[model samples]
Target: MKDSTQGTSPGPGTPLPDSILIVGGGVFGLSTALALAARHSGKITLVESSPTIPNPHGSSIDTSRIVRADYAKAAYATLAESALEKWRNTDWGREGRYTQSGLVLVSSGDQFGKDYVRESYENVKAINPDAVEALPTRRDVERAAPGYGSGLHVSGGYVNWGSGWADAEASVAFARKKVEETGRVNFRTGDVKRVISEDTGSAAAAARRKVTGVELADNTIITADLVILATGAWTGRLVDLRGRAEATGQALAYIRISDEEQAKLANMPTVLNLSTGMFIIPPRNNLLKIARHAYGYRNPQRVPSPADSGSNPTQTRETTIEVSLPEKDVPIPQEGEDACRVALKEMLPAFADRPFVKTRVCWYTDTPKGDFIITHHPQYNGLFLATGGSGHGFKFLPVLGDKVVDAIQGRLVPELQKLWAWPESPPAAAPPPPSSSSPDTVVWTEDGSRSGPKGMILMDELAKGGWKRSSSKL
Candidate 1:
């Protein structure tokens, strides 16, 4: 019953609270808030600037593709294995959840494309040797889909039964529904200006300078014992807590397909074009979603409010839905679409004339490396950093939430550390933890001391941005 929305410090040995505040309400944010709600019971509250789950300018809600367990990294494989099960089991009956449509990799023979085939094939083979196989020739691929007979070129790489898609928007709605019923969370429509931390000193200050609460853009202040800033693309907007703003931008698109073509390719599975750096996903209600593998697009740092989308009720949902092609200055590129059309035509050529129906965009928050950044701020003891998802975070949202929970609890997560640690930039040459003499515990300085690792070499790789942490309130 503490004003769970407002901040108040714990005095002396007085027990600190279990109540928490969750910011943002997107898929990851909602899922994290709901998972933490289930984990901590009625001890969480969610603050959202939008009235609903899918922010119009946000990522598409219709996608159902999940990369599954064929990931190259051991951590990713294990996490995907668990997430696949959760998606299958309905994880407590959340609708528009996971469906195993499997994933297909297509290539016309470029270095990156070949690399994708090799990597995906290697990963799949290591796990289930029989899961991946190469198609013999273009004729064989054409046999798989009537359309591919002429237009599609086949390098023939694919992972069967491992990858799939999910209803992203529905997933968000489901998670929100689950957490909404908890009665501990109240979804208020207000923008978060900053996450204010309490001031505390010394080791005993564990209960001291932790996140006190958040301030809304309206000037109304809300506080809590703990705060989780899960806002997506706008994550850095929360606070400048010791260099946590490190956010990047990314974008995604959806291609329009004919109703008949959509149905034909509906079962076509998620296909990655290694050569073109494009991916085609079969989404809900019959649509093919296309996106690029790289990031660094023209998406701005801040998304406009609902009003900016001309999203007024009279404006209509169709009016709010918008799309932008890969190159900002150029006209929407038809080359990617042409590639997809040709490939799909080869696979099932019934509709070469069918043009891309619609398009939309979304962002990815990236770290210096493509890995996630989930840790505590060294200087700001109370705040935990959970941004930097790059592009691959969606498939691992649940596990990521669990890791965030571990960080909030202040316990070292061994498995998580491998993925989250900035090994190259060990925490600034500050005094070592009390017990450990050697600073073997790697840390990254905001000044770029710990940017990457040995295996994770830098390639001037595109920095795509992506969001959310969790809470403990009802």
Candidate 2:
């Protein structure tokens, strides 16, 4: 792999072609579109399957997402640090969109020897010593945030005052507005069927193909000089990622905090249990968002539509029924609810009995090592990919678009180039076959014992060991 610092290969240069089409208007697509519109004098068109820019099912679309630079890896830590700078300086940071409440990391053991929390603390400290502060014991953690060390055994950890949270959905909307004002970028709402390609000759026939543009579900064929697949989670449905990525749906729950509890926990920072991959966002609008950062459940039944079927390949249709809307029919599964409950009970017991105002099965396009893929297609010319958020991409919202632009221009730094490059071959363990039942008909389950919306138990019903019907709103 070539070093990205050497800059993109000598070719068309940073100036993009006149017509550029981006499929999937999530974080990756919008950010890249905005960057391109600012840099290149061209008409950039973005196709979003959903009705709006921030597709409600997109990993980028959410109420609140953590923004922290305490990464176990130095490269990501550096990127996050740069992203934080932009978050604080840009409009996205101001206007009450970003909250710098700091971040707390809790570990089950000492701050050394293979502990993720310790590694993160050490890495962040390496960048800026003052940015990280050690909490030597559970008492130290509780002292920093009252009742934070209640049920959990917090041996030691650290707090990065530089970290905080962002309103993800709002941030995306703001970016969309900025790009729209430029007039160079046009937002088109429709499901992309597939990348329209053409065979040039015998040389291009055997191996290489040129992507001309994309065809929509309505059979509207829009041509372009370049086509970028920024479809998060649904990338596999559009292109063969060679087992590099797969969509895994993780669980997220919003617990309604009482006025008293909200006031008491108002100052609490975003808390992360590095060992368990569980984290809690600060209270906002009387709701506390709790989620996990693990390899979540694969939707075994929701298979991607065949590319030749003339159907939307972005999985937008399935997502709309499964998650895009606030419909009460979407089930979060008992396992998801229990996972949040267990983590919260151990970390913040006071809020364990709070009612779950809402629950969601957020999806992520996961990679094996959690590194993002931001390279061009090996077999198809004029085709590029910017997917693979791997659950942690939201935090890098401020600067991720520029990186994608760098990737498109082949100007990625050496470290990032090697990290984001496509693998020569697929992994040893083959990815599961892309076959599943219909997303609408499939039943969500927890350990395969019980299923349906009822399995997503309410907090008040947890003690009774039975389902308790409740409204799905605060």
Clashes of each: 40, 4
**How far is 347's C-alpha from truth in model 2 (Å)?**
2.1
Highest TM-score: which candidate?
2
Which sections of candidate 1 miss by over 4 Å?
Answer: 1-17, 91-96, 107-110, 134-150, 201-210, 239-259, 299-355, 397-399, 410-413, 422-474
lDDT digits (tens) for residues 1-474 of candidate 2: 111233344455455677889888888888888888777787789989989777776777778888988777677888888788888888879877798888888776732222666778887887778777899887888776674656766676888988999999899898888889888887888988767877656654546667799889899998998888888877766675535666666678998877987887767888877656678888877888888766465543233443322122223343411321112224466767888898889878877877788988677777766778898877777888888787778878767877788777766776887888876665554233245322332222111111122212223233244533353331
What C-alpha lDDT values do all the predictions have?
0.51, 0.70
RMSD of each: 13.1, 7.2
RMSD from true fold, candidate 1: 13.1
Q: Which ten residues in a row have the lowest lDDT in candidate 1?
A: 465-474
TM-score for each predicted model, relative to the true structure? 0.70, 0.83
Candidate 2 deviation (Cα RMSD): 7.2
